[model samples]
Target: MLNTWYYSDAPRTVRPMLSVMRRQSGFAEIIGDIDQENATFEARRCLSCGNCFECDNCYGVCPDNAIRKLGPGNRFEFKYDYCKGCGLCPSECPCGAIMMIPEEI
Candidate 1:
């Protein structure tokens, strides 16, 4: 045991890269459609460098539903009794917020 939760068998879903370019409204139009919502989502796609941004990736992917939401800005917590140590939460964690520590005897 490396004292960590490593899910080597977890399946990873690869999403296609979206190219968001400034597209003109018309063939000859110079103005573009400012999609602020889409832009914001795309902006969040940037690498978080292993920080919790409360994106809910871990919370959403937990099969056991062991991860509990602590409301907005509070992040989440693991219900160890229900967690079963499946490593699903750690694997699905996009920002590496969940670290798997080995259970000591």
Candidate 2:
């Protein structure tokens, strides 16, 4: 297992280590390195809160038809070519899943 130590804004240095069962670390392993056991323990602490996994609720309900569906049927994509930056989709998301970021200048 790989162990990483980094500084946080709160205070002293932090050390994050990968779980014992895993052999190597990936991107998630890096981010979740802090107190592997504790982090994994906390990860399961979520309430789920009736959330949807990128359900594409916004993509399906766009009024301007700006959203584009890419990838396979299981995985869809959203294109903002004709998007007016309307807050409808973001507002309509039940799980607060979609967030509207300002387009790059």
Candidate 3:
């Protein structure tokens, strides 16, 4: 056995987004279209933010049928109309993407 370590020296890449000045128009869709390379690179950034990766875990685990399946790669939506805040989604989420926020009445 020998002691050796190595890592890629290439700089990290980022997806291009609209500048704050131009985004203030509220036209929606701040992120610009990216090439296949950047798209793949951007997709890898999901885990860094605890973003939903469309794993369908919460969708299957919801007992109230509150989790709405928004199609492939679109992630999911909490159907508050049916959801009772059972805290199941957040607990079942593998990536810690689901969160529970108490509503004040």
* Top-scoring candidate (TM-score): 1
Clashes (candidate 3): 0
For all candidates, the clash counts are 0, 5, 0
Estimate the Cα RMSD of every predicted model relative to the unseen true structure.
10.5, 13.6, 13.9
Q: For residues 1-105, could you state the per-residue lDDT of candidate 2 as single tens digits?
A: 101121122333356556655636444554344566666655554433345344576677799888766645444445667788888876766555456787789
Q: If ranked by TM-score, best first, what sequence of candidates would result? A: 1, 3, 2
Task: For candidate 3, write residues 6-57 as lDDT tens digits.
Answer: 1123445765788898899879788777788977765554442366767677
Tell me the lDDT of candidate 1.
0.66
lDDT, candidate 1, 1-105, per-residue tens: 121233233333333333334233334334444366656655645555566778787788888989899999888888889988888777777657678999999
lDDT of 2: 0.56
Q: Report the error of model 2 at residue 37, Å.
A: 30
User: Which consecutive 10 residues in model 3 have the weakest lDDT in total?
Assistant: 1-10
- Of candidate 2, the 10-residue stretch with the lowest lDDT total is 1-10
Would you list the clashing residue pairs of candidate 2? 16-33, 16-34, 17-33, 68-79, 70-77
Would you list the rank order by lDDT, best first? 3, 1, 2
